[model samples]
Target: MTTTSVGAPKPTRHTADSEGPRRSVRRRSLGDLRVALIFVAPALLGFVLFYLVPTIRGIYLSFTDYSILGNPIWVGVKNYVKIFQDKLFWNAMGVTLEYVLLNIAFQTVIAVGLALLMYHVAKSTLIRGILLMPYLVANVIVALLWFWMLDYQIGIVNQVLQWMGMPRVAFFGNEFWAIPTVAFVNVWRHMGYTALLIFAGLQAIPGHLYEVANLDGASRWQTFWKITMPLLRPVLLLVMVVTITGSFQIFDTVAVTTQGGPINASRVIQYYIYERAFSQQDFGYGSALSVILFVILAVVAFLQMKFLRGNENDLD
Candidate 1:
């Protein structure tokens, strides 16, 4: 419908429809980006200030002899060397490793079991809240509650044991039982919390998958193994990573119940760090240990991520 010079007659023009949509989409994306940045800025700033900055500064301080009140003295790797040579450091590290392993085992198995039980039962808000009640309690309170429950003389647990004709044994007072007792208490407090997280993952699984499995006459065990466990890998890995970090850094329960007692048996890396940095005023060595712990957690988390991503590709 356009007119032009005779030589340029019939020159074609493209419609604006396609280009218009592309431009509109770009504008909308930019708008969304701006909104996202605005919303995340406060949290991002807090994280950088509180966590990232401290982490970087702490790592730098690990190579220096630092006391909070004085300027840091350049110590190179002297602190690290001392930590490596210290027998108590290795003992604490061993205890931390054992705690992490036991916690991961208990938390993973018990959480998964409880999650499965919840998934099968009638879904009720009350039930969910009750399950998570212990997790909501403060760490100190959880420790105190378990401490009383496991007390040798006046504790209900020992009384019940006595009723069953079993001898009453001191849990935290014995070096051999101290670590396991604290680990068990931690599991009891956190099992429901982890289970609820896993339950949410269980809920996300498509119902049609189960229906198809049912139609194929798959046994419950086979369906659970073949379908549920595979689909739940990501969530399980998340729980494992978190629980491992927490176990390695456990402090409140040990402080309240055992105080790393009976022979420093229940002393974890976090408590060790605390005693060194604050109580004994050995900031440099503490920072070195902190760096070591950070490295350990980073390696574990990276491994978990690698495994999770590998499963994703396989699942796809």
Candidate 2:
């Protein structure tokens, strides 16, 4: 045998061979990381500039008494205190909750039905495009279109009602109908997009599972309830979280059509914040409202993910 140093062991061919591959892998990983960083840099920069900076600034402004005319003066929890006692704030909150409930209840049901219809009956891309047409239109345009269509006096809907010997409905003018009409408008706008999202989730489901269900003599309703709904839970929860958050931020439709009319019936929390900020020039209060809304959304999202298990996949 060849003599070696007393304390030093000779390197084996196995070790040498393993090290070469390991070094190459390490270098490749570093290269991949650089490429990834380069690709993500734009999105990261945009997030920092547009989202993160504004959020931090809004939080800072929330604690002050700025009115857009002078420098912000720190006032601690004064704004929060005022908000707690503000009647209009509570009314806006109540109206917003009502709108969210109505919008989500109807939107989720209709979207699920539409998605199932698309999956089972019509898998055409052209059909999907047609369905998504409403969503692609500008929100302002949609609101205006609906506003003219549902007008109490001169709208086509009213004209049809008159032809059918039915009384006219004051869709935007009546307090009782105002919130529901607005909620319906948004539901109509968002239904197709939500359906497409659920459709994607449905696509991920294994065909073999459905085949097995059929072999077991399961009916369509049984298959849906057992296999489809259970596996589709995560997607449903995710969709709910997204839709609920968006519903809470209802502003454009109300702004375009009602302008929070019928005595604050359609005054959502966001519109109230807008009223406080730009309309009244109470930037500090508006900032405070914004911070509150952010916190609420964060809490809601966290609770939904935690309790509803939004991220968990049963497919695993």
Best by lDDT: 2
How do the residues 1-316 of candidate 1 rate in per-residue lDDT, one tens digit apiece? 0111222211111222344565665666556555656676787778779988999999888999988889999899999999999888899999988888888898889999989989998478788789899999999999899899889989999999999999987988888889888999889899999999999989988899999999999999999999999888877877777887778889999989888778879878898898899888888888999999999888988888886773462245
Candidate 1 structure, TM-score to reference: 0.86
- How far residue 214's Cα lies from its native spot in candidate 1, in Å, is 1.8
Using TM-score as the measure, the top candidate is: 2
For candidate 1, give the lDDT of residue 126.
86
Q: lDDT by residue for model 2 over 1-316, one digit each (tens)?
A: 1122211222332354566666665656556556656676787778779988889999999999998898999999999999999898899999999999999999999998999999999889899889899899999999999999999989999999999999999999999999999999998999999999999889999999999999999999999999999999999999999999999999999998888989989899999999999999999999999898889999998999999988889999
| CA-lDDT, candidates in order | 0.84, 0.89
Question: Scored by Cα lDDT, where does model 1 land?
Answer: 0.84
Error of 1 at 308 (Å): 3.6
Q: List clashing residue pairs in candidate 2.
A: none
Q: With candidate 2 superimposed using the best TM-score fit, by how many Å does residue 180's alpha carbon deviate from the native?
A: 0.9
Question: How far in Å is the alpha carbon of 226 misplaced in model 2?
Answer: 1.1
Write down the worst ten-residue block by lDDT for model 2: 1-10
